[model samples]
Structure formats: structure tokens, C-alpha cells
Target: MPVAAKADVVVVGGGPGGFAAALQAARMGASVVLVEKFDMPGGVHTSGLQGAANEGVGGIHTELMARFEAAGYIYIATEETLPEWTGNPLSHYEKMKKPGDRFSRSSFNPEGAGSIMSAMLAEAGVEAMFGTAFLDVALNEYGDGIDAIIVANASGIQAIQGRIFIDGTGTSELVARAGAPFVRGGGPQPSGADWDGRHRPIPGGLLWTMSGVDFTKTAAHQKTAKDPTLAKLIAEADAAGDIPQGLYRPRMTGKGVYGEHYIGHPTLDMSPIEAPDSFILWQNVPYEWALHMDDDARDEARAKSALRGFIDAEAQFLRKYVPGFENAYLTNVGRYVGTRDGRHPLGEYIFSIDDAQQGRSFDDAVTSPMTKTFFWDGFKRHTFQVPYRCFLPKKIDNLLLTGASLSFSYETIFMVMRNFPWCTQTGEIAGFAAARSVEQGIGPKELQWDQPYF
Candidate 1:
């Protein structure tokens, strides 16, 4: 492919990180181009219907959330009254559907998110190349920086040149392509010689949604101190074959809240599918092991189909034994699978577990303290700061890494990464840094986080 266009900054993803990068760079007066392999912009947050941005956020996050709110996509969780999630589903978001103090969540329509991304980018003067996938990179003659990137689309292969490249690709395809060092995603280290007592590597899985659920009824089934009927229903289901014998226990609740493993199967989050309607919700099914995203495409597709079967069985257990889901039907499944781990480009500095929870101060910190990041180990938690150097690579002169693939040790990555708000905040950092790099004719290797990129 021949060089098709030149951009002051080219963002290689369309997720929150990529979207924020493109918009931020452009707002800073750089000619920015955002290329998304997918048609929509929200990526997993939108498509996976994450439905929960529970961590409190601010900055551009405030603006984007306002749009989702105005569009009636934001649903705040509350410790108080949550509406009857089932029945003639109430559009009014009040009352916790499940029992106990409910954490507020924001669930939006994926289709709506696509439009919001477009408007935000356009308003910021960013040019977007949708449905374009990044392939590989061609480094400059000295191999110190990228010359251009090759991409594929309907018109075939084309080259996109930019002064700086931001890898918000989630998988860190650029780093992998550039033959950079990264951690391999797999099971957490086992105990003993293989065991590290502190590091429990939880497996990752895919997210899928179901529609036409009597979420009110489903919520009722999630027996809390306030309610017991849902617990009773699960007890009955477990006695019967519907809930699976030894391995399956029908907490019959949202998976995120409880990482319960029942019968013979591994732990799974039966989170009440978070959606606009009460009757519709998705279960983020955990896998037997963490998925390898770099696996062959055909193999990956087959694996997804297999995972869907397990999820379908889980759904069937609820429908057959649970009270609220008698007529519940499968409306949709996630287009992207959730990976707990991925490529972690070695950066100038990587935040550690202690840094994430207690909050470490970095002289070059681009994120505010209000931008909360945490790692979860059952009941325990550690919060930390996301430093600018996490995205700044040690080798790539003109490249910045964003999204879930930023440099972090296996022990602390998932706790620190994940979620839309945090990633977008980092995206803004990468964006401003890219613009500054171009303006000063400096590479990311020479950029300093202590100085203002603006």
C-alpha cells in the first residue's frame, strides 16, 4: 500500500482511549486522525454494554457523561430506592434493583454511543477513519521511529503517516508488531514454587447480554438482607438439575458483585445484565482460563461460540428455575471478549500495586488524584496513580501506549487498568503528549511528563 494521508497525530483505536486521544490532540491544534477497526467508538464500554462506570470520574469524563445523561443513557446506582426492575419497566432510574446498598451505574445504548463519539470528535476537529484496521508499521531508516503505518479497509491497504503514533489498540498491536517486550497473559501464578501468595491471577472471559428479562423479578431473585425470595429460588434451583448439580449455585445475581464458583465450574459473575430496560441484562461470563487475544482468528471465533454455549446454559438455569426470567430471551451477546491481561509496553516508569491503592505522587502525573484506579482481590483493594511514564515507552521514540495495555506488572495491571473513565483520562494524556511531541519536533523518548504538553 502507498502512503494515503499524513496526520500530525494518528490514533490507532476508537475506544475511549483512542477517542479521547484524537479529540485532545485536535483540540490542542494538531491535525489528528482517529482510525477505528470497528464501526462504533465506545469499543467494549459501548459494545460490551459495560453498563457500569462505577468509579467516580471527572474532566472530559464529565462532558461525555452529560451527553449520555441528556440522551437518557446514564443510570445512576443508589443505596436508596431502585425501581421495580421488572414489570412495565420503569424508564425512571431510581431504587436499587438488587438488594443492599447498590452502587450507581451508567448503562447506555451502544447505538447512541456511536453517535456521541462522532459528535465529540467532530466538535474537536478530529478526522475519523472508521472500519479501518491497523496492520503493521514501517519504521524510519534508522529504525528509531515509525515512518508510517499500514492499514486495511474496503479500498484495500493504505499507509497513514503521522508525526506521532498512539497505540490505544488495547492489545498493543503496535508494540507487538514492533517486537517490543511485553508480559504474557495467562493464569495468575500458582501457589508454592509456582505460587506467589499475593498474586492471584484471575482468569478473564467474554461479556454478553440478554433482553426481555423481568429484571425487577430478577432483582427480586437476588436475595439481599432486604429480600430473601431470590435466595430461596436459587436454593430450589440448585436442588434441581436446572441449576447444575455440585458445580452450579444460583446466586442468580449479577456476576460482578460476587465471584462465586459453584458445582464443578469456575467462578462467574452473573451480574444482572446492565441495560436501559429492567427486563434486559447481560451476564459477564468468566472463562475457565484467561483468553489469549493473539490467538488465530478462526480459533478465536470458535472459542467464542463455545463460550456462548456455556453462557446459554447458565441463562437456561435461571429461566427454568428463577422467578423473574420465565420468558427471558437472549437479545444480544458481546461483540468483544474481555481480556484481563494483554501487551504491557515497557515504559519509563510503571506503577506498582502499592502505588495504585495508597496513591503514589509522581512528578509527571498526567491524571488527577480524583481519577481513582483500583485492583480487586476478593474483599481487599489497592488504589494507585497512573503516571505519564506508564504510557511513554522506553524504546519507541515517537510512540505512546494507551488503553489496557499500558506498562504495569502482572501483579497490579488489572486492578489499575480496566474501566472506560480511567482509560479515557490516560488517553487525554497521550493525546496532549503527542501534540507536544510534534510541536517541539521531539519524540516520546525525549518528552517529559513534568512539563506541560500543551
Candidate 2:
């Protein structure tokens, strides 16, 4: 017989979504249990090596940033002072700003993010079980509520029961395990029909980071002059067949410090479930660079080969074309790929692209000002709300899901659902709702979607 421990609420998968859910539930006075496969929290933001938080979903999301700032973990990107150009105005005109300055967006350090998230979870006093994997969910005899969850840890399989459960797993593992209906790759399985009856898989994506950069020197180089050779090289690289067009953009995380160049490639079928560690690269290479490599050695070789190509190309560009980077080095790559789309649960409300574009605010809006979908493209911005119905499955009365796997359409996902902050916001709402439902002694489905909370 397994030891059964009960809690007011149970949250599985300790990523940003799970952590926020657990923290918010505990703060609301619920005895919450947060289970994570890893030893620490912050999911992609910490372990995955995804770069810093952005300013989108405010309120609780803003509070997370405050904690990081209060802990001396925040940094600002500053503009470089450019030197005066000589000769014709266009002849020696200086670039004035770093490559990342093409867009005005805030960025942060991953190390800082990890530190602050760990601190926040510790301060919240939520009972966290790290290095634990959720095996199966035991349903009530009526098949309406989740009676207990079986998890495998170092000790063995333990059955933990809770009045309410929140699934923060990006893959919706809990919801699927509980026998709830779900759709992977942007539509229903087998047919892949979306809400509007279109076919699409959840958009698969990747994120890589470059290191060995001299921030100060790069800033200086940008300010001193614009070299035509460098511009040509950039244009040439942009035209490369493997590189995704229009997805390459620079993001500065710190002032005269670290930065990132985002390359969004949708054709690469590197799903989170299939290639969790595929994003860590030592260099920037063609998207099909892994096609010929052996399956067993692909991951390792991809990192090395891609990184070498990236560094060498960058070095040549900086030395011969760009002004700075004469001594730039390749630093570290991301630990996990920055996934944009994945499997989502089938729920009562499937948020669509039309809803997102129209700025449709739900009557049961858990959080206000659900903004538009902000994808890799720098120019597009859309605001939309996440209805409470999206959190609960139509059939499952006890289980709730949040994060990237929430109920939404492929068009909606492509439009507004890809935002990470929105996922965090949804997570917070799901946690609060689950706790409230448990305290009220009602099935999660019974909670009014019109006005989620009294």
C-alpha cells in the first residue's frame, strides 16, 4: 500500500506556469503541493536557458519581475554613444546602436531569472517535491474527479491525493493521463481539424543562444562606424537557405552586456516531446544540418558543428565586416529548446484567432487586458483574453490545465497564444480557481465561467 498524503491543491510540472500556480495558491492560504521533474523551479526560464522575462502580462506577472528586481537581478539595456562620421554624410555614417537595437524591447539574464524564481518559491512556503515524475492519475469511482495521483520518485511510487489538481505540464500529461480528450499539433489527433476546421500541428520551434561576445567592444564598434562589408555579410546570411527569413532579430538583455539573436524556424519538426534538448547549440548552422547526422549522435554533433559554424562566421563577419567582435568568443548555448507550440487539451472554450484579433475580452476573464499574440515578428501585436472555460476540460471535473497546452486553436496559437507571459497568467488563474473550488467543495466544472470568482 502506498502512503497517501492529502493537500488542498496539487500542481504538477514546476515550470513558470506551475511555479506561479503553486505560489499564487499558497499565497491565497491553500496548502499546495508543487511537483516538478527537475530539482528546481522556473522550467524553461531557468533550466531551458530561455532568456529573460518580458513586460506583457502585468499584475502577478509584474510581481514576479519585482521580486527579481528587488533581489538585485535586473539589468537595463543602454544605448551606445556614436562617434561623428567624416567624409560624405552617408559615406562614413555610424550605426549608433547595437544590432539588438533594431527593436525596442526589454530583455533579462537567465541566471538572474533562475535566482529570483528559486527565491520566490522558497519564500512562498509551498511544499515542493522536486525530481518527481507523475505516473498516473487515479480517478474517482464516478469518473468525475481525480481522487489521487500516482507519482514516481526516488523512494518509489507514492499516491498523493488532493481536493483539486492543476496540470502545468507543457504537454498536458496529467489531463491526457486522466482520460480527458486532447489535441496535439494544433488540432484534434488523427484528423487534425482545428476549431475552424483547419489542419495544423502545434507550430514546432527552436531557440539558441550565443556566447563569447564582448558587449562593451560590440557597443563601441557599433558606435564608431558602419562597415558596408558587415552589412553585405548580414544580408548574405539572411539569404541563406537554411536560415528562416525575417525571424533573425537581435535582443539585448543587459546594458553593454549579453544579447541574443532569435531565429524562428517552423519547418524543423523538433517537438518538445521528441527533441527536448535539441535547442542547445554551440554554433549557428543551416536548419537541415542534422538531416545527414546519425540519430544517436545527432544532438551532440549538432551542438558542436552548428556552434563552430556560427562562431567562425560571426568572427569573420566581425573581423572583416562589422566594427567590433575582433576578439569575440562563443560562450554557452541554451540547455533546452525554446518551444513555441505543443499539445493542448480539448476543453469547452477553444480560443480562436478571430477572438484574439478582435481583442475579445471574456466575461469570465480571469485577468484583464489579455493582449494580442506576440510572436517572433517584431511588428505584430494582438491583445486577447483567456476565458475561465479554457482551463477546465469539458469532461474532467477535478483537473485543470494551464500554460502553452491550454485550450486554444491553431490560428489563435499562431496569433496570440504563443506568448509565454500569457501562459503564466493563465497558470495563475488556474491555480487560484482550483484552490477556490477545493475550498468550496465543488467540482471544478461547477465553478461559474461567467464570473470565475465571487
Candidate 3:
């Protein structure tokens, strides 16, 4: 096979985690190569959500914020205006129409994000390969460590060797392909029901934007406890059989109308972007039901076809009842699903939501509450810190993993591992760990980050 450019660190997947891993390693003077299946970086942050890049968590994340700010691609809308019901009995999702305070986040122009990621990679001297897919891994003669990774791109199939590898792929593709052991999204569903594994999968979503929205008129339909415009609309739609039951549980984060199941309730669910238009909000548009993200069942072709059809049906509802969206149009549908959970890398450590809630740390912590904002669940306003062991494969010496596919179970991944901010910091940690391992002639499991590398 041909030889793809090798580096000290090879980060597969150019999403938020891969972006941070590659950028941090390269900035630290390591020859790094970042391979992405998509032509652009920013994974869900750019192409998927378009503006859900939450708060500036750390130096690197803050730097991304500065770039976005300079490009006029976003605005942080975490502060809340509907403070009267701060502690209402109702869940946060049902209390108001515009619910985003603890869930404070920013939005960005996808184009601007791509340009920024590209420019930053170049500035950091990182070799980034887009439209590249990671096939499988070649083990060493002893079958104890990874020798090289097989990849396919415009250059055809090739192999790339590295002292250390970082599996930033959101789906744990590298780790799985390497024959590593992992767990699927099976067990008791959040609804208090057991899943059969094959039939029941975790809930994944895709976010999109609506253009030509009349913000002025839509802005007026904000809901209060006494006058809930969003609830009213859902009721009318449900009565007309246009909306389905169990689609809008209001307080549940999974109940997003922009979801594959329902369209966002203008004022209740979404927020405005920083662009000339602010039609984009936190809505989903993928698998309304269970779909194993790691399985081929949730591949691109199937998700796209299903979501586009839902948008068509959603558009009719938007035009008739929703005030601001009366003239709104589907600007663009996301190319990839904002997958919440996937197979774990089964690292040396299994980071759990319980550990985060308890404010856990490790002797080799790559991220702590001090280095960056810890534990942001956007849904429950939860916060916690992550340890370095979460990224280390339990048995693989030369390989490491990061991002949502770290080690959390289906029930808890969304609360911690999957958040883009945390994933970004973890990527930075993975990169620095890979570089540190190379410099010390050691493996990532033996790497240390008890001190601040950034």
C-alpha cells in the first residue's frame, strides 16, 4: 500500500475533538496529521449545528470564540430574560418559550467556522487531510500495538504510522476497527423500559436552520406560564393530527422540535444566530426513535432521506401557525447527524456521569475544573471535570481516544462526553499526551498531564 504522510500524532476525525487534538499537538511543535471524512472540519459545530458551539470553556475554546467573533459568525445567548419562573415547578423546557440561560451557547456561520478551522490548522502548521476515511488498523508483528492505519482518500488506499494515535472519531471507528472491545447503547431506556440492543438504539439528532424568518413577529410570541404560545401551537397541531403525542415533552432536552420528530417551537426551543438572520435554533432533525449510531442503519443516506421528508411536513406547519416562520424557508439540512452516543473506546478509565457529578480527578488528569468549564449538560445545568484516563484505551498502549465516544454509557454520554466544549478540551489533552509520549519515548497510557500543557 502507499504511504500516507506520517506524523507523531495521527488524529482521525476532524470534528471538534479532532480539531482540538491536531491544533494543540501541532502548536506544541509536534508533526501532526488530522484526517477527516468530511471535506471540512468543525464536525457538528460547523456543518451539523451551525451555532451550538457553547461557551468559551478554555484557552483553545476561547480562541475559537475570538475567531468566531472576529468573523462576525456568532453571539452568546446564554443569559435569560424570562427570570420570573426561575424555579418553577415545571421543567426548564416547559417553563418558557425561549429557554437558554444555563444552556448559554454561541452560534457561528458554517462557512466562517470552516475558514477559521482551516486557517488555524495552517497557522499551527498542522497537516490536515479532508475527505479522508479511516479504514482499519494494522497491528505490529507481536499483535500488541498498532503498527499503522489504513486509509482511503483521493490518493487511494495508504498506510500511515505514528508513535501515538488519537481516535477523535465521534463513532470510535479507529478503536472498533482495531478489534478493541466496546459496549453498545443497550439496556434500560430513559423512559424506564429495557431495550433489546438490536431494536432499541440511542436517540440521535440533526440540527438545521430556517431562512427568511420574521424575527420581529416571531419574537413577540414568547411564552409565559399563563400564556404559553408554544404549548398552544402544539395542542392545536396535535388536535389536527399534524403533531404527534410524546414528541414535545417540553422539559426533556431530547424533545426538540428541530428534531427529526418535530420542528422547533420557534420561541420555545431555538435561539437566534449572530448572522444577518437568526432563524437557526437548537432543534433536531434525525432519528426520532432509536437508531444505533455506530451501526450502518444510521448511515448518511438513510438519515438524509428521512429528515428531508420530515422538513417538508414541518414546513407546512411552520407556514400556517408559527408567526415568525410564516415566510420561513428551509435554508439547509445538516449533512451528518449530531449523534449523541456511540460505542465506547473502553479506555483505561470509564468516565461516568457520577464521577463528574462528584467532581472527580486523576493523577494524570488532562482536564480539570480549573483548566476549563467542567460538566455542562445544557439540559440540567450540571457541571463536572474529566480525567486523562478516559481517553486511554485499557489495553492499547499506543492508541488513545477522545470525544463523545470516550467511555460513557448511552444513558450518560450526552450529559458529559458528548458536549463539544468538553470534547474540545479532551482533544487538546489527547494531542498533548500524544506529543508528550513521543518526546519521552513512551506510550499514551504512560503519558502525564498533571500539569498544565497549555
| TM-score for each model | 0.80, 0.70, 0.82
Local distance difference test, each candidate = 0.64, 0.58, 0.66
Residue 66 in candidate 3 has what lDDT?
Answer: 81
The prediction achieving the highest lDDT against the true structure is 3
Q: Please give the ranking of all candidate structures by lDDT, highest first, separated by commas.
A: 3, 1, 2
Model 1 residue 373 CA deviation (Å) reads 7.0
For 1-454, candidate 3 gives per-residue lDDT tens digits of: 8887888888899888889989988988889988888878888877675566556877678899788888877765433622322222222232443343354445677867888988899899988998888888998877668888999999899998887888888888888887777876543443322323443444566666777776445445644224344667767777898854334444324322222223223323444555434445344432335556565664645655665555565666777777767777777667677666577667777776566556665666554454222323334434455667778776667888877668665545654456777678778878778877888888877765576443
| Position 298, candidate 1: lDDT | 62
Could you report the Cα RMSD, in angstroms, for every candidate shown? Answer: 5.5, 9.1, 5.0
- Prediction 2 TM-score vs. true: 0.70
lDDT of 1 by residue, 393-428 (tens): 666778888877687766565544656777887788
lDDT of 1 at 78: 39
Best by TM-score: 3
Which runs in model 2 stand beyond 4 Å of their true positions? 81-105, 186-212, 215-331, 358-361, 369-384, 449-454
- The true-structure Cα RMSD of candidate 1 reads 5.5
